[model samples]
Target: MTDIHPTAIVETGAAIGENVRVGPYSTVGPNVRLADNVVLESHVVVAGHTEVGAGTHIFPFASIGHKPQDLKYAGEETRLLIGKNNQIREHVTMNPGTSGGGGLTRVGDNGLFMMGSHVGHDCKVGNFAILANNATLAGHVELADHVILGGLSAVRQWTRIGTGAIVGGMTGVEFDVIPFGSVIGDRARLAGLNLIGLKRKEFPREQIHALRAAYRDLFDTEDGTLRARAEAVAETAADQPLVKMVTDFILEKDDRRFCTPRSGE
Candidate 1:
């Protein structure tokens, strides 16, 4: 029971699942697969080796599953995998991965990608993430579940944003962000804990209090290096999963530095 507009063009090899809808002027490439309950609004172009999971809705002019933007890309058969229940708004662009980046760009379920937002090639976005209008991720970035990027924000390539972190508007994030952390600035200085997000998630008040304490210990104290402090916090707060999440993120091996509080603030 699929509905395809007369003006739509679905290539012969494209797989359109049951109950899907294709709007006018949209194009589905031969290698594209639209799962059950998918909806493609007018003027959409889903190309390359892309798979749209069930219950996903794509708005007009979304150039999804396009070839990687990298200069090194040479017509390789890379893939873009979009998970279920995503709302991809107008003018959003998502590219497939290049051979150099494992040949895959994957997005998890329930993401809200606002207008003009871009998910660059080779990026991995987790579930429940929200990319506000014009937010962008460079290639090779990793965004964990429940992360929020404010309008006009951008994440640098190779950086990782841990779960529940929030980046404020117009920020340019060049380093890893710890779990539940809040960062704001033109250059992304760590602001504080994501207290609003934590509370919205309904985390226990005691756990939230412990996490705040650990945050102060990890950043406010000047007694040791950040790694040393994170290690100490991890040991003492072993019973706090949220605290451990941040400490583990800090301890993980990565080439980039992390966002830190600015001087005198």
Candidate 2:
């Protein structure tokens, strides 16, 4: 019982699953596949070899699965794979992958892409993330679970944002943001833990306390490299899971500089 408006265009060979609705003037391309209970509001265009998962709702003027904006893209076959229960709002653009980027762009489940947000080619955005209005992710960026990009924030190409990080409004992130870090300023710097989010998600209070102490020890000290300080904390707070996660992320094989707290804070 898929209900598609007469004015909408479902190209031949497109796959629309049960209980889906394609609204007025929307277009589903030949290579598009909409899973069960998907809803495309008016004027949405889903193109390319895209597979939108079940229970996703896309609003008007969303341009999904378009060709990558990369100048290096020479029209090779690429794909955008979106997971379940995402809310993609008006004027959001999610481009397909490019050959140079391994030919796939992946979005995990339960994301909220607000108005005018753009996910660049080859980005891997993780589950439970929120990209606020006008937030932009450059090509090949990887966002770990529960990351939140505030309005007008942007990340440079190839940067990896760790789990539970928050990039504040108008910030430009040029480095890797640590998990649970709150970053701000035009050129981003880590401010502190995202305490609100961590509390809302019900992270263990004792572990949060340990992470705060470790944050002060790791970043506040001028004595050691970040990895070295994190290693020390890992040894001391080794029983704390959050501390271990922070240390592991610090020691992981990442190319970008780790975001550090401002000198005073």
Candidate 3:
């Protein structure tokens, strides 16, 4: 029960699963694989070695599985893996990986990539994430589950955004963001916890309070280095998983700095 418009081009080697639809002027490349119930709207181009999971819907003008924009890429075989139930909106451009970046870019289930959002080469995007209009991830960025990038935001290469974190509109995020963190500013800085998201998720009030306290101790106090403060908080909030999420993220080995509250804020 697959429907492909007469004007659409499905290459000979393309794999189309059950109940799939390819709209007018769209092109499915030879190496592309569309799973069951996938829909590609008019004028979409799915190329390279890309795989779209079942139940995903791609809107018009989306350029999926394009070659990596990296100059280092020398026409090597790479792949873009998009998970199930994702909504990829118009003008979204997602590129595959490069040989330098392990040759794979992965997106997890239930993501919403709004218009003009770009997923760069080798990026790892987790489940339930949303990238607002014009939001962009540079190469090798990693977004943990439930992360949200507001409109016009851009993340620097190699930065990792922890689970449940949200980056506000128009921000340029150069540093890692801790789990459940809210960050905003032209140049990003940690604002606070994502209280609204936590409440929506029904996180326990006690756990939220403990996480808040631990966040204060970790960031507000200027008595020690971030790592030392995170270690202390880890010891004190050892039993609180929510608090531990932040501490563990801070303690994890990485060369990049993380977003922190503004001085004297």
All candidates: CA RMSD (Å): 0.8, 1.0, 0.7
Q: Model 3: per-residue lDDT, tens digit, 48-125?
A: 999999999999999999888899999999999999999999999999999999999999999999999999999999
TM-scores, all models, native as reference = 0.99, 0.97, 0.99
* lDDT against the true structure, each candidate: 0.96, 0.94, 0.96
lDDT of 3: 0.96
What clash pairs does model 1 have? none
Off by over 4 Å in 1: none
Tens digits of per-residue lDDT for model 1, 51-156: 9999999999999998888999999889999999999999999999989999999999999999999999999999999999999999989999999999999999
- State each candidate's clash count: 0, 0, 0
Please provide, for model 2 over 202-231, each residue's C-alpha lDDT reduced to its tens digit, 9 standing for 90 to 100. 988998999999998988888977877877
TM-score of 3: 0.99
Which whole-number lDDT from 0 to 100 does residue 191 have in model 1? 96
